[model samples]
Target: MKEENLIVRSVTKKKYSSYAGEITPATPNLIQRNFKAEAPDKK
Candidate 1:
């Protein structure tokens, strides 16, 4: 029962989500966020 208290109880029972409410509306972004890179090997 040591190993640094089982790695601090497995990092305080880790489970995290910042998926921003898990986007819905039948989810389809497909780069529509337009991370613009018209050149440089098209990013």
Candidate 2:
């Protein structure tokens, strides 16, 4: 039980950090660009 709690706490902290990192102003546009780039080639 104690080990599980520690693992959950560490995962939660990392998730929060990742969430904070993802909300930056540049994130959306970069994601959109990459998404477009990855689409099937129109040929």
Candidate 3:
């Protein structure tokens, strides 16, 4: 019988709000709530 070696890795998850803080002045939603598609090609 043979034994195999295993490796483990660790990762740190980042928060969306934390990343947004890096930017100066939050961006505005120019499109607003208008989600109507103009045309099939444009969409």
Candidate 4:
């Protein structure tokens, strides 16, 4: 049970870090690219 809880916590932390990475200025171009790729399909 403890191992299972630890795994869940690690997964949650990884998800938060992944999301945090997107909004960081270091990857601003990456966000722009993602929006560009999606915009054409939306229109």
- What are the lDDT scores of the predictions, listed in order? 0.68, 0.48, 0.66, 0.49
Candidates 3 and 4 compared by lDDT, better number:
3
Estimate TM-scores for all models. 0.17, 0.12, 0.33, 0.12
Q: Pick the candidate with the highest TM-score.
A: 3
Q: Write the per-residue lDDT of candidate 1 for residues 1-43, one digit (tens) a residue.
A: 5855654334455588666765666877777878889787674
Residues 1-43 of candidate 4 have per-residue lDDT tens digits of 7866654344344334434444544534545555455556672
Query: In model 4, what are the clashing residue pairs, if there are any?
Result: none
Total clashing pairs for each candidate: 0, 0, 0, 0
Better of 2 and 4 by lDDT: 4
Considering summed lDDT, which 10 consecutive residues are worst modelled in model 2? 7-16
Clashing pairs in 3: none
lDDT of 2 by residue, 6-41 (tens): 543444443334344455554445344454544577
Which runs of model 2 end up more than 4 angstroms from their true locations?
6-43
- Lowest summed lDDT window (length 10), candidate 1: 3-12
Where model 4 places Cα greater than 4 Å from the true spot, the runs are 6-43
* Candidate 1, residue 19: lDDT: 68
User: Could you tell which candidate, 2 or 3, scores higher by lDDT?
Assistant: 3
Candidate 3, which segments miss by more than 4 Å at Cα? 1-23, 41-43
lDDT of 3 by residue, 1-43 (tens): 1355655667879755645445578798876877778786553
